[model samples]
Target chain A: MPHERVIRHGRVEPDAWRFVGLDEGEDLQALPHGAIVVPLAVWKARRDALLARLEPLGVWLEPHDEPGEIAADLPRLALVAVRFPKFTDGRGYSTASLLRRRYRYAGELRAFGDIGRDQLFYLARVGFDSYRLPEHRDPEAALAAFGDFSLRYQGSVDDPVPLFRKRAAVEVRHG
Target chain B: MYRYDEHDRKIIAERVAQFRDQTRRFLAGELSEDEFRPLRLQNGLYIQRHAPMYRIAVPYGVLGSRQLRKLAAITRRYDRSYGHFTTRHNLQLNWPRLEDIPDILAELAEVEMHSVQTSGNDVRNITTDHFAGIAADEIADPRPYAEIVRQWASFHPEFAYLPRKFKIAVNASAEDRTVLKLHDIGLELRRNDAGELGFRVHAGGGMGRTPILAEVIRDFVPWRHVLTYCESILRVYNRYGRRDNIWKARIKILVKTLGVEEFRARVEEDWAELQDSQNVITDAEYARVAAHFAPPAYEPPSDDDQAFAYAVASDRAFARWVGRNVHAHKRPGYAAVTLSLKRAGTPPGDITADEMDLVADLADRYGFGEVRVTHEQNLVLPDVRERDLHDLWQRIRGARLATPTVGLVGDIISCPGGDLCSLANAKTLPIAEALLQRFEDLDYQHDVGELDLNISGCMNSCGHHHVGHIGILGVDKNGSEWYQVTIGGRQGREAALGHVIGPSFAAAQMPEVVEKLIATYLEHRVDAERFVDTVERIGIAPFKTRVYGAGKELARAA
Candidate 1:
């Protein structure tokens, strides 16, 4: 099979994990082989069975799925991926921030589906560690988007201290 | 005016570069139209009916003389010889080539003005009372808070792609000049008995297709926590605001569907986590921003102004202009003057390049080096010496900018309807022209007294017709243009939406219909009673009866 490219920390890398999706009423017994990410519903329904099988488990969420649902499962989970149905559907940014900040999810957080270079910087600010680039976009050229701005005003998961507080700290140090 | 710091300047410069690249990619056929639409719109570029419309942001309605000169230069160089000032305190260049926009943005960045967040689904330019800081009845200077909010909302990563366009307005004065009730989030700065500053926060108010007044989400949010509080409101709306339908996507729909109480509860729950977060505003930061808005150097305050009194006594024209156009300044020796843009022949908010240069010169000479754009589509020199009234009046009269009808019948707020806007249902400028011709006489208009006659081409309410004392809305009937009239709407301390009088009328009969309504007000009004007051005292019946009852009078008048 051809390599599935992922932009992780502004570097192009081959994606290692395979996403295993389940349709309605599909049994979780038939699963993909290597390090795999399952749907949140499937993981929730067959938690013990999936834990029993040693496939290095991870879970992915749809746009409407709340991060709180997977809060308690963060410790055991290896990675969490949020799906963006469309580029403009921005609920994933908020969800990513909640997972990192509120739920304190320390594992790898990834954004997949319909994302492009334009969304990379914003996704990084909200604590997404990896991105699945569309097939048409060149991953090497997309790295330029991360350095688009040298300054930001608001606090986010990347920098919890806002610019104003940083400026205040500078003032005190100079004094 | 607040000058951009190096950090602020860097952000805007980077944004211009980013947009330039985006435009190049789109032109190269690398990005689809759907993908490029939001990117271009967030930078305030719109594909309009005839050409691309570029909106330049005037943050909190403040402009320096140098910036106005740069705008004038850009207008003359890039667009047609004129640009329209929008009711949101923005400047719209109607006819500009798409390729020339990056260069225009670069020139704009030189003057520290950018069009970011002027359109699209992001936090728009924060607006406040045009008379902020100088208004006699103001509780506190609202500019600092507005500037703070502007910085916080600028290029916000999380809330950039909201369900729809969001607007926030701050007001500290007793009067609601900023249309506080019509914004998605309205912040009213107040002081408690202990002299602590806080905001009476209202959320979910809007005026598009469905007009709903915002409810008090939090009666008092301390100044320190204002940013976090605003974040809570935005986050709730961002996560849950409907994205399926464009019409029902505003926070107002979400607020209405869940009810204000539930909305408030969700916001409070969100705020609980963010209140102590790093986004909490600091006193040092507030002071740093507030220092930019401190009062300009003025002569010693004195009640006696012999020159001003002599000018008023000598020239009746100057006295009339003073009576109508000049607003009372908080300082004894100064007054704020509104330069009327609503002359008879021209469109309401349209300003030519030459006129812009002249206004810039006038601002430097007569007042402070700053000017303000009123939401009523007029320019204000916020700090003019009272003694310069006669000189200023004489200087501006020849340009027809000295119209003494600031709040009168001739002062109509209108949107660029079908003549320019693709979304408009009918042409509004011609009707505005007809009304201006009918009420051209200064004496007749002054006799009519304070009235807000606003016209909108559609339900978007860009003209703010819903809050006009006499509102005219354009409706499409059978593929033809028709006018719908509403009565008794008033904005200010008590903001109320107008009610429709009767049925819609043909476009040609609009002036006559307005005449009939004004005649009814004159006939039924008690001494010194305003048109809206008379309509309120004796309801909309008499106006309706006259406007609908008089078909013969229209023919006679025509």
Candidate 2:
């Protein structure tokens, strides 16, 4: 048998968690542990009430408005899903960097919406742990984009020290 | 010149390696034409009308003798023994082979230069007043800020692919010699009432396809926020600029569509979020960069020669040359001289390898081992001492570079049109040659006085035909080349786009048309008025009626 789906807050049925946003009367507060996703507006409006209940059970938040705002709640927020809105909109990348650096939030940062194979390396550089591929895209091909460049010119979250610093350190050691 | 730091050197080396791999993959068929197109473009290699053309970046048009020698060596090795200096202060090699591009890039990297970001839908070579540090009229040197912008925009992950290519020009000079209004982002450095240096910013100006003048977006942006604010504007453009049509993809189209007020508001909104970011330049960093561009140590010479004045008064030919060619310098005993490349029967902006070596040698001997490539497609020795003017003039005359037509009609701005560029509709060089031959009389040219005649092979406006006081555009009618003339376009501080005078004339009739236009200007102008001022005063009606009607009649009779 498949693993048992855990539902919280008594408002949602375990079987109906996969497609919560489609229904008008769906109770987002009682979303199942693994599959449910919430819109940014709903999460922002009832964030306090949702955090009160969701903190104990450890729930994932999809499309969080302020990743920095909810960073203190990272122990419970298993995965923070960021939205791209458009491929060229780079605010989410900055938001992710801030979440990782300032808050030291180690939970998975998943990027979705218009995320293409070409933008993967940059996403990785800014601290995105995983990506929700756009529908109809091959995940294996998209995975290859993460390592397109073997070397980087600048320092980033993934590599806190720049290439020059590292090279100089190595040179000093050998010299 | 800003010497490459370790980081800068490493970045260029890595970028060269990246391009080498990309080229190898392209040769091995691992990358398709479409896949490799943007990569090659970002590396400044373009598949032009005939072969691949590689534009090497010469940041802010200041080059030392060593860098120039590298360019000369590159020309001799990878391309023909010639290169074209573009209006954006970069150099273009016409005949670079595709397979040997990697080796060429390696050579460029060795000299602290590369073709990166020279062409593409990315931040192109950031240009500033060519006479930045050396110009007497300048309030501040603009190269440090230009270099800062270059570093910030180079291979920027977010802005690498924008709506279209972006150009930024900074001018700190009183006269706006860099044609700031023709750039996408025109910055004028100004000091506030409190004596704080800041920038007055303009946005959305461009020339290709739909020509539009830039509109002032900010009265004064503080110097600290220059990089972050510019990045914010680029971010807004990258997100919202049209991508559907290639022609309408430039920021000018968006500015036109949203109106300048709305565009300014959008940029402000973006800047508000980025104002306090890490990208904001600090005072220390600003000082560090500025220190790199501080003026060279100069001891004031005691010898003041009135020889040039006496020579000019004595010799009419030399006087005419001085009147047209010599520009005042800020230093007491120096002047900047423009060696006109638009000599009769020579292709505009084409200087042979031998000429380049000679100019390089002259720069070492006379002018501080530094040379500048001007936007008007001429070579400038910015620090020629007044005392050495005669000796330098003799040497330049021997090399046939003393054309004595700096701002005259014979100093025509012509593009490498159908002969080189793929986008041209008609041949521009031959037409330029014809006009130059007709206007060869030095006395007649000086009498005409400060006429800007620009020619572009097409409406892409690389030759900046729209802003020329006397503009000539090459057009194709049936199977033959035709020329369209316009009047009163000026690209200086009081920038204005030229207006089309009338119908197109055949190639053979181009010289006659130019003659009639000049004659009309002379007849109708108030005393000492320029071609632009005369056209502005009387309008194109009197000039057009005379040139197109009675002037054509006179030509027919002759």
Candidate 3:
């Protein structure tokens, strides 16, 4: 097997889980023996059967799929992967925010597909903990992107306080 | 004149560093052209017809003398000896190299400016009334709110990769100087019955291939909830705005499809949830930004200067310039002066390195150490003292910046057309030059009286042809260029789009067609009615008849 690199919490690590049934006719039965991730439709169709297997399980979603579809299943999953399809297709960002902020999903969240070095900083800010860099790119070099900006002005999933509020707090403390 | 704090400084520095790496990667062939296009565009670098163009944001049209001087230095070093001031109140360097842009952005950060979000699918530079603080009829200063929104929209993680480019404009003056109704989101400051400040917001209006005026979605959103309200509107646009077709991707089409009432309902639902979030603007934060825009120190009003009165009486040129270029100020002893960029021979908003340096020096010497870029593509010395009018005029004339045609026929706003922009259908500068040559006599321009003529190379409306009193649009038929004329569009209180007069004309006949329209207006006016007013009253019938009826005469004249 080829070595797959996953960036989690700004560090490179091996990806333990395998994604299954990504293609239209891929078999859901007789899956790999280790950790496995299923598609959203497959998870909905064979929820109890997949749960009965007991090995680590996760679900992945397409860009247009609603995060609310997996809200009740959050507690049963070990990971949730959101596919970007294209870096410019930004509907996934809102989906990530809704999954983390509204649904309060605390498991590992990963971003896959068209994830470039330039997108890592913004992805991390909106609550994605793991990134599967495309195969041709260097995951080690892309790790530097997370530190690209030392400060951000607006609130995000990483930090809920905007810069102005923080500055105002500092002013009050000093006074 | 909003100064950068530690947070602002660090963010801009980091953005410069980030862009430097992106440029390096692209040059090394690691990033494809498709991948690099949006990244470079977000940093305000466009691959124009001749070379790379860099646009620098002049936030809310405000510029400090030091900042303007820095821009002059940048143009001198990184580009041709000049820059073009756009209708959106930003400055564009037409000939910068791709390798030199990161250095340019680093230099910009030293003066508290950046090209971030200047041109991209993300939020653009927030624009407001040029006379934001000094306008006599404003309910309250809009700069503080504009600053707040600017910070919120900067590098916003969720809205960064929007379906299409978005623009937001703020206005507080009674006259709507920023063309509020033509923006994706327009906020007008108002005071409720309880004397508390808030905004009357309009959403989903834009000008491009399709032009639609924005409808007021909310009558009142409290001051503290402005950020949340805007966030709600943006979220709705980002999630559902059409991504299938690039031409139909703007928020204007989305609003039109869903109907304004349904769009408002969806936005209200989002706002109701976000109102109590940490995104709310705190009182302390509002005070922090508002303090930066407070009234500047001014000496008390004194008796009118005798020399100014004498110069006005003796020199008709000086008197006419004052009548057209000077505007009333909220303070008694001060006045806002527009330094015209529309000289007879030059393209409308093009200013040279020497001109930029000279304007900075004048701003420092005659007024506060600040200047404004108006949406009309001119510069403003926002707080010039009335007592120094004569000396300022003489000094301004030394640079040929004193063109006494502020709103007259000679003052034409035009885009960088087929000459530079790859998207243009025809060349706009030659048409503008012909019009200027025909009206070269300043006496004739003044007699024409307060006519707004705007030209666009295409329907993208970068020159704002939709709102001009007499708008000219460039078109292409077969392989040759043609010009279409529209009359009666106006921008201020009751804004409306112009009506197309008839079929298009060749480039050579543009000047004659405009002259015939002007002749009709001159003949039909009662008292000193403006061209737009006359067109509105007599309608397009008589003007169309005059131009199309005398085709043989026009052919002979041509």
Candidate 4:
């Protein structure tokens, strides 16, 4: 199995996990314990069914909602999954922020779907901890996205301090 | 104008350092062009046709003398010694090296300013009427609310990267100087029966390849929920707004696809969840922000200004200026003066270094040490005492800033088209000069009664030619200059795009074509009907018949 990063809420740690994609009406009962992936539409439609099934196996399911929908389920779930859907659909970004700040969901937040190298930094800021890109994409490229910018103009998940507070610290150090 | 408190100052300073580090990383090649693109854009730095253009935010079009001087110094030090004031109440410097931008931003930060969110797909500088605090018809000063929105939208994590650029404009006056209908989100401040301030929210209005007039989404959203509600709208747009096609990327397209009713439903649904969260403004926070923009210590002055009247009567030039430049202020003895840049031969909104410094000094002496930049591309003194009009006129005249033609034919709004902007197809300044030459009579212009003559280099409509009463759009015909004339466009409360009269005219014949149209309007108009009202009444048929007839006649004669 390839190396995997396990994210439960805002924290990241290494874990031995395998990919388990779910199809519509597929019995998730056969899935391995821990965490599993599901489509956003299917998850929304059968949330109760999947929750009931997963409760017995000690597995948590990550429902990838479109970015704006994440705020609706705020303060309830411990872990929410966001999907890139496509390389460009930025809905996941707003979803992650809504989940983190608006809902105050402190559980694991994982990013799956069309996650790739270019979007790692932004995903991190919006409160995504573990990234699950496609098998073909280079993990190094995705990891490099984390260090693209040394500074950010606004506050985000990666740093709770607003840009102003960060700048004041720098000013004091230099002044 | 909103004074910066410690929180505001700290925010701007932090943004500067963040941009500086981004610039450093970009230079070090740690960040590729694709990676650094949005980051730099959020800081208001754009690599345009020639060099990087830095757009500095002037919230609600208000600036102090100190800020203006700082801008002047920045231009002198780093840029090409000039800056262009945009329709969104921001200033743009066309040529600045990439490495020098951080220094420029740092200088801007010194004056409590930043270019944050001025560009990119994020929320842009929140704009309001240039006459926000001073307009006579204003219900309340819109800047405080505008400043509040500015803080809420600034560096917002969720809406930072939308499908396309977002613009929000607030209009507090009956006369919509901010052109509320042409923005992505327009908030009109109105009072209910209880005299509580609320906003009539209009959504999805924009101009580009696809121009759209906004639809009323909410009749009354309480002023306190302004930030939370706006966040909800932006959140919806960010998630569902189209990103597949660049042309179809704006919230306007999403609003159009979903329809206003469905869009409003989704927004209301989103707001229902977020309203009680931290996004909602607390009463204490509201008072804190509002206090920064509280009205300055204004003492009631004697209304009797016999001296100014005497001065104006004594000097013919001064009288023309006072008649044209002076505007009714909200205060009893105060007047707002517009220093026109529409001199006959100069570029429409181009102010030289000397002129800028001179204006800065005038702002310090005559006004309350503050200056404003209008969307119409003019400078304003928001609080000039009626008693000081004559002395102010003399100072402005000495600097050649007294153009005595605000809202006249000479007060044309021309884009820096083909000469500067790479997107432009034809030259706009020459046509503006031609119009100025033809209409030398101030008495004739004042009689013409408030015509907006706008010229754009191309259909990109940066000059907002679509909404000009007499719109001139530049077109390229067989590699030579050609112009298209449109009539009936207006940008006020009843905003409407102009209709093209007929075939395009050659460069030489533009003055004659415009003159004929004006003459037609003068002849056909019912008593006191402005150009727009006349065109609305008579339709574009008569003007088309006259202009096309003249075009045909000129062609045959040629």
Candidate 5:
């Protein structure tokens, strides 16, 4: 359990990326140079200008945003954070999977907004390395949820090969 | 029943511990109702009218003797000495303290059972015909496939939360005993021209305020691709199923909006990618699961068992029971017996702890130590030898389970109405009792014959009133309990939703209204046509006219 720690893949690390929402309307250039995340629209509009800077860049994606556009910018962006407008809506999980698997974006992937602590295990399995738990929730207690289940049946972004294939591989190996 | 492997056991054990922590957080004032609602729902805990009702999924409704004993003990310890079997083929303990649920779930896990996804927005316990593996007409056993689906859907990362509660039912026989068209995903196992086992997949079927039957999404998907196909459908539903309005959030509404042709196209597109995934079922895996369900030992009888014939000939009551309760098995010497949980003067599926313990013992003695909970909320010994039928009947009779009303009028499917549920608009138990009283004559009920009478507390259709031959839906009119009756519904291969006869009637008038409909059916000149068939043949005109006698205000509410 990464108690009081932030997860980046299988390792625990201090969170470095700072979130900037769509409605915040802040000037992206004024934010901390390397740790800044602007909305997907802003990143799409000013991709060349943002990439010209001498620092790693980030873009935030919501469930409704076009994640396909990020494929070309995968090498440019250091962090990709997915936002869920509501806890009940799970489209962002799929969006994260596509970003990691289809787009092959291996940079830091984070989940924020309306994504509760209870969803951490699933989000982690689906290739989310970081989470910004809603303001009221405690991150320490939420860490226990990460190691709640050790086995997963289906393949996701983090583990492209599913458990059954691995199980069969082990059986063949031992034999 | 599929025996749990290390993978299965580990997952279930971890889930119990996870839920224990969740319950602690919920009680410690750390998790609000809003935050904990879905979490508690995933564990099958609901805060009903009187108290919390915890429902445990009886996966495919098959339980070993050990599991049955565990359930009996749980109910005996934590609840009102009994549990209610639901239409989804799950069990509900009516009066468990909120805090005791984690313990109940832990105990359930020890028995290789848990209530996970039983009452959540995710996929529910997969249901099938009680006589699934042993049915004479079945092409293949659907249990292995059902078990695969159950494991695949458990704790699904993407679909843990969906637009609404989803249900799936599997049927292998030509007969649709599980009400195939009335679930979110209905899988009917079949064989193609080349005699390869496949599935006829249907999606977007549900019954609530709006009841829409499923459309065939795939005519034939081979057994190897079942999980991948299911994933495609679910992922598409997760992507496009309505999330704005809870009332219209079911897959049925989505199919209605998108058109089945377009919906099928979307699922096919998803399936195109999923086919290459590791979700596919190989022969090795299928055989391992099939080994668990392979038939038990059987001893063949002579041309005719004189002892059995003598018992059936001598005991009139036993003969009647054999006719109604005994279903022919694929194995000639073995038969499946439906133990009626629909005894008169009690809520339809309420079986006491003592009754469960007795049934467990009965399963051990007569059955091959297996009991199946039917979607109709009855129990079955799926592999009872025909030679031991008389002896089994005697034990069941002693336990008040041999009701001789398996598919008869008295075998009513009902929901925990206003009596126990906060969501119920009216109480259905009292109404059930009144009907049972009016038709207590065993011979008279037998004469009525083959009536699928189902009653729901409201239009939620938990009792599956939509597919009943005689459907009763309770309504709230000016704080008074009223019921609307529907007729001409059937659940098998050619499933159809029942149509409302006319205006709703007061609770007092329900029994008489039903009696008038039955009288109309009796008076019609039909030779051996069942009640639903008669209603379908002649239309609802005759029955409606008799029930609303001379009242011009009546209009069909179909």
Candidate 6:
């Protein structure tokens, strides 16, 4: 794919990570050099073994194994990718935001599995810094959707001060 | 009414553009129909039987006269020159082209409005007491807090998608008017021992196929942490709420299955992580929003003017209206007047563009340039002076907006039902039309006294049938529409779901069934006992035996 793959802070970048889905069951011993994303079940079961490896590692959370459940293991994970299972099932949006805001998982938060161009904008605002788009989607348009709104009301992973606080700060400076 | 600030305005403007792009993509076949459904629904656009229906959120049911006039203009230009006020206090335009929705949203954004999350599986428009600031019994106005929550919840990334549609209602009055117990999360404003305002939180209450009253989640949460507390609840619901079954998707079901104790424990787990979060509302933030809802300028107390006294004393029609449609206000010389939308033979909340403009003009003249939409599906002029009420009443009556049945039999709360809603099992407007015509006599209705007849086209309870004094739910029986009647429901400080009377009745037998229920109540009444009071005093058995013949066992629990 020629178009940029991930949008972070209104800019896109080429994809790098290798997502080894649970269905694939990739051989952990013979993994590629780049970052490897494994399933939650795999991560939980082989936590000791995976941590001992030299290569970078992360876990992909399905809708049910949300960020709230894996809080204790968040410190060592370098790239947390939350799978949508289905684009319409938005439980991952909460999982992504909580990983960034609550669990403080300061890794590359990405959206995977059934990800679409339209959902990328919302997913990005909620703190997904990377994306693994479905094969047919246009990544160029998905990247442009990130800058769709220049103003927002609530505080989020991207902007900590909500609009009201921002307005208050502006008022104090101008007055 | 709360005026939007620059930030609020800009957000709405950008939202219009955002939805515009989404609509453009959908039209160009960049997004599939399945993908576009949530995008349109969250923006308050629904595909109905014949045309695309647009729902405009009237947040907390308070809007300026100028906003209403704008709505009139929009409905006239884009739709069929009218809009219907929803039971959730939204304005619905029944006929609009799918392509025109973006333009409509753009027009709405000019007035600091857009229908963001009137539907879809997200946090819907937060609701509260229609008589928020003006009511005499309320400890404090809840609109400020409601606004704060509204801003926070708007475009909230994490909560944008959920298992099912979520609803929140706030009440400041000692007596709940917004039906707090029927919401996903209910907040009641009260003061603790230190005399500082806080909220009594109720979670998991909702009306649908399964009706359950919300149990108390927390005794009190201070005003400063309201937003954080709410976010905690949403996080738990989003992360753990069932996605396998659409039937069990609402937060109410999650609360039921987990039990309120476990639900609170899960929420506390979420709140524990949010202790030092920036989402905590500051005093300055609360005050900024509160300033927009400051009390209307009130005049000093005055004795009843002779003209007002004489007008009511001489004309029994005027007297009956003043008796039922008017409510006491906090200001001594002021009154709040409810303009009945449930006129005979009309859809319950349907108001023409002409009526909209007229109501706006009346609100400017007699009120503080504001109108309120109530949960009971009516409009309220909240700041009318008692001295000017007679003339206001006269003008309102001339406009055909005056129906002297506020809480009486004629003031039915109904949904658009099968008329426009694709999910409805039956058309509800005809039922409303029949009941209104049957009980057109003011004396007959007044003598009948204080009955709430709520109807829903389906079990979604958009009509809030579960909490009505007498609830009627539309059931689909192998292709025909049947009405199931329930009695003794009440919505207030002591909210209770109605009990099913018996087997469902056909369309023709509904009025007779309701008449029989009323007749039974009147026979057993002691002095001023209402239909609800009488039913409560006795039980549903007498009413049941009368409607379904003697010796019939109860089919459903209350």
What lDDT score goes with residue B482 in model 2? 75
Please provide, for model 5 over B1-558, each residue's C-alpha lDDT reduced to its tens digit, 9 standing for 90 to 100: 788878888988899888888889889988888888899999999999889988999999898989999999999899988999999889998899999988998898888999999887998899998888888888888899888788888888878878899999999987889999999999989889999999999999999999989999999999999888988888778877888898899999999999999999989987887777777887777877889998887777567677888999999999999999999988877789999998776789999999999889988988778899988889998888888999889878977899899898899999989999988999999988898888888998888889999999997899888898999999888887878888988788889999988789877777888898999999993878899989988999999888887574333221
Q: In model 4, what are the clashing residue pairs, if there are any?
A: A8-A108, A9-A107, A9-A108, A67-A91
lDDT of 5: 0.85
Writing each residue's lDDT as its tens digit, candidate 3 over A4-70 gives 8899878899889799876677777767777888889889998998999899999999888888999
Candidate achieving higher DockQ, 5 or 6: 6
Residue B326 alpha-carbon offset, candidate 1, angstroms? 0.2
Best by TM-score: 1
TM-score of each: 0.97, 0.83, 0.96, 0.86, 0.95, 0.96
Candidate closest to the true structure, highest DockQ: 1
Q: What is the C-alpha lDDT profile of model 6 across B1-558, one tens digit per residue?
A: 678877778788888888998899899998889889998999999999879988999999998888999999999999999999988889999999999999998888888788999999999999999999988899999999988888888888778779999999999998889989989999999999999999999989999999989989998999888888898999889988998988899999999999989999989888887777787888788888888888877777667466777887898988999999999998877889999898876799999999999999999999789999998989999999887888888898978899999999999999999989899998788888888888888889999999999999998999989988999999998888988888889999889999987788777777877888999999999998899999999999898878766644233222
Q: Where does model 3 sit among the CAPRI classes?
A: medium
DockQ of 5: 0.56
Worst 10 residues of 5 chain A by lDDT: A1-10
Q: After superposition, which runs of candidate 1 have C-alpha atoms over 4 Å from their true positions?
A: A1-3, A22-29, B302-304, B550-558
lDDT of each structure?
0.90, 0.76, 0.89, 0.77, 0.85, 0.86
Q: What is the TM-score of chain A alone in each candidate?
A: 0.92, 0.73, 0.96, 0.66, 0.84, 0.84
Off by over 4 Å in 2: A1-175, B304-306, B476-481, B550-558
Clashes of each: 0, 0, 0, 4, 0, 0
Better of 1 and 6 by TM-score: 1
Per-residue lDDT for B154-254 in model 1, tens only?
A: 98889888999999999999888988988999999998777899999999989888888888899899999999999889988989999999889999999
RMSD of each: 2.3, 6.9, 2.2, 5.3, 2.8, 2.5
TM-score of 6: 0.96
Give the residue spans of candidate 5 off by over 4 A: A1-7, A10-15, A24-35, A43-55, A166-170, A173-175, B552-558
True contacts kept of each: 0.66, 0.03, 0.72, 0.26, 0.50, 0.75
DockQ score, prediction 1: 0.76
Worst 10 residues of 5 chain B by lDDT: B549-558
